[model samples]
Target: MQGSTHGIPIDTDKSSPIIVDLIYRLKIRDVMTSTILSCRPEQTMQDAQKLMKDNSITGVPVMVERRLVGIVSMDDVINALMTGTMGQPIEKHMSRQVIVLEDDMPLSFGISWLDKYRYGRFPVLNAKKELVGIITSRDIIVTLLLEMNKEIERFEEATSHREASTSGFHLEYTTRRFDFEMAGRLSTETKRQLKERDLPPKIIRRVAVAAYELEMNQVVHSAGGTVRVVYDGNQGRVEILAQDTGPGIPDVESALSEGFSTATEWVRSLGFGAGMGLPNTQRVSDAFSIESSPAGTCVKVTIATEERSNP
Candidate 1:
């Protein structure tokens, strides 16, 4: 960081950890400008200069057909102007010893190359060694700033989620048909959320069980649905809702009955569709309701925690 190539001001030791991660995580292709203005080697240096001027760029890569052969920078144009050589062909005046960056390299590598060479820009090549784009210090800075802002937003949103568990909060998630892999995610999330609160273990277990059963119901029984949890901190209650676009349950009574299941053979083979999902959810809840139709089915369950507000 101390003896960096040049122009790049990032010091890994002192910069935010998030920024350091970004430099390493982002690839050259992610930051470089894919839409590039290039010049044929046979074109006049004046032509490259005009391209730079019109585009407000400091450098341009010189290409021979599709191959990148050289680059002309602002200094090159200035020298040509001072020496009255602007009309000379690019191939004759362009710096032929071009330093290039590969599209797959990390942004950290680009930062190093830019500082190491102190060049205005670097030609970007693909795995096939084809010229694809170009990179500059400005691009790295702008992209890092943009990505850092996004990370900050995510961090803030997570903090808000933790806070919402104490206040009145409603969280919703989409569940897919037969997505057994994700079946317990909402329940696990519920456990994690309640564990941070002052609620008793019995109350927490009831909420987690209700969440898991409802989430599993959507994954195994419903075509697909949304699972929602609303915590009424003032009333010391947690409400869980499973609403599904459905062919509708033929027997709502059978669905609520213990040891009753409509799940197919394949679902049962996966150790699901035990017919206990709705029963378990309803057993753990202080309030329960179910509505079914050809259009959809919605089940709501509420767990009453201790009569206390969040600390």
Candidate 2:
């Protein structure tokens, strides 16, 4: 549970700029934004516009009698006014069915919400009918990207700075071109690395699941891929890069669907391509990102030492 940034020790007592990444680990309760600006459900469209401008935000949660009833955004106000209905009540246009996240949920869950929903922001609430804070898409992106870069730097530091232990084990493998045989080899190397590092049982399982799905994606869909495993100090982490030069998935949205598949009959006979590889990768990896195009696809997955408890 020790957290720091850029080799600088972080103080647990004070709120500082770097405190975000550290406080994020302690628990969501401590880092929530408590001072929220809310509006009434029956407020006028003009009222919402002024509130948004005053707060420099695009939306505000609508609370009736201190209870969150809906969310009113600038868009809702504009839509109301643009139709020559400036005098209309805000409730007519406000989104009553608001999506909320509990204060205890990890920042990782916010990633899934942003990816799955069209809203650019979210309302954070506590168990006792209290608005704790707002967790926006930008916040989630910044936290994850920072954490991912931190991990990459940590890996580079360990590989270049510290000397390998005399009694330790080392195994490296490189993969080129996409083929069925190569998939099995990558999987084997992954299990071998987990065994050698003696990583925590929970982390090992998550890494294995993510690796299996990623390798299969490259073998069945992409042009080529690479897998590497290294032991760094007392903990272990796995990094996998899968790249391919085939006609990339034209529609990432469709590909991420639960039962959508582009695999041919030959590939399907192997019990592969239930259209769950990418989605499952998203579900399993602690940090997952995708950059894809018609020319190729590149996917990166990382496993950290920190354990996540799901509700």
Candidate 3:
């Protein structure tokens, strides 16, 4: 089974630049909860249940000093309770066959293991093979989202420094508001063109994301707009412009905030706007900007053609 790496369901090998960079950048040790509450081998099953209840957790590692001996899940406790064994020592009912994640392993490995084992959490072991912390799927999710938010904020701060470049190729497409069906056509075409030109996969992905976000913003929020693509073959840069005719965004500052949007209820139900458009575009682009007025809104994104897109 494919491991989901993000809230939007990402693959370990392929995903948004922001996410791929994040998963690779982080390690299991960084995300796991270091302050662990545990149950000892001699502790009763009833004790494990209480520990879980008090901490709002589903599983407790049975520990001997600093060593992890086994894990007793809520399921084990329930079975023990129904079978009238809640009074039994936790070690007796705990799953002796433990799966663990190494502290130094990449977060991607943790994600895959969580998916593969279908476990609610895994014990984390240091090089000396001592239990250092515990990691859960929820832990992975929360860290990624929080880190992504911080990274996006950093990108937004850099948007004022637009890349200085000259254009080599140009193309434009008209986008109708609420045109969900055809919304991604421009980015799709742009990606294919870049791929045919033998551009690096990494840069191609950043350009595709920048173009798609710009295109999607116009389609989902603007009245009607034009998506312009300017590819500089010399510098290997892709500049995209998404400009709408009218009914401009009332608050540009609020619009740029992630998870803030003006998309209608029906549009949101279709999953169009969780308010990541501008943030995502700005995040992927090496240079970005947004200008709006009662007449219209225009978003600009620039991604370099170099293999190291951001550098």
Candidate 4:
């Protein structure tokens, strides 16, 4: 929960630069394979293995009367084969405590679940807890790559009308509650702009991390918010402001505490609210300020284009 990056203390934050690339405004149902190949719990292990081989899939969801019961994978088959239990009922060999994904959940939840559990695939269920589809890490990778390319195309189109050598640029983006699909697009664009300006890598990195964390915090925690970025060539600094009209933080001091979180389980599932946003932003910024009340919250983070040499 406590670590240092290039000697800068990192709290319970787990936001990664690579996360900006993976974050998309997508839901699990958007990418899940709706036509699932599955078996029944009463089926024999040999039968399940044959189904897996016929479909060329490593795993299959086990359903019993439209309810998800378990999942059987190639590893289970191999174990059964070794133990001479191939003819046994699949329910006896399959993993009963299956980690499943819901249809409406964000793609980030799937990404986090796979990364945390190292599962080859997950059985997706609907609101009624019925097996609806299946998704694999490959699906997530392909979808994210496509989304990233689309974002790049959009960024190019948006910037095409602007003067290339403009002294400064100011932009604002709106974020909505649970808007996971569009979470990191603005930050990615900001990073692109910084790269075009040829800012120092350290500065760009700090801005990228700050922008991503702020964007995600708004998307996950706020009712709705506006993220504004102002780059000043004269001052050699980029300023980011996030203002949200959500239920504001009651205790700013406690919210900044490492590992402190009031996020719901659903939010935590998508990998936010480990109590790192404000602290991480402050750590990377040249200046930071925050204000909150029941009506709303506003956070301002400023990073200089010039990197500060390590003392």
Evaluated with lDDT, which candidate comes out highest? 1
Residue-level lDDT of model 4, residues 35-149, one tens digit each, is 9888898899999999999888999999888988899999999999999999999999999999999999877678778867888999998998888899998888888788877
Candidate 2 lDDT over residue span 1-311, tens digit each: 23432323344335454445443563444434567888887788888888888878898988877688889887887888789776777888889888988888755345456666768778888888577787775565565566666766467546733454642323334444446755655455556556565667677677677777877887777666555445444544556666666568888888877789988888899889889988988787767778888888877776665564752
Which regions in candidate 1 have their CA more than 4 angstroms from the true location?
Answer: 1-16, 166-311
Write down the TM-score of every candidate: 0.52, 0.42, 0.50, 0.53
lDDT of each residue in 1-311, candidate 3, tens digit only: 24554432476456677877778679999999999888899999989999999989999999999888999999999899899999999989999999999999888888878768888999999999998999998999899888987887578435522442233556677889888877887787778667767888988888888888878888887788899887888876888988899788899898889999888899889877889988888888888888899899988888877766254
Q: Which residue pairs show backbone clashes in model 3?
A: 236-305
Rank the candidate models, highest TM-score first: 4, 1, 3, 2
lDDT of 1 by residue, 1-311 (tens): 34332544676767778877788789999999999899998889889899999999999988777988888888999999999999999877889899999999889889888878879789999999999999998998899888987898579559758678455676677899889877786777677667767678999899889888888888887789999988887887999998999867889999999999888999899887889988888898889999999888999898888843753
Q: What is the lDDT of residue 230 in candidate 3?
A: 79
Model 2, position 182, has a per-residue lDDT of 52
In order, what lDDT does every prediction score?
A: 0.85, 0.68, 0.84, 0.84
**Span of ten consecutive residues with least summed lDDT in model 4:** 3-12
Count clashing pairs, candidate 2. 1
Badly placed stretches (over 4 Å) of model 3 are: 1-14, 163-311
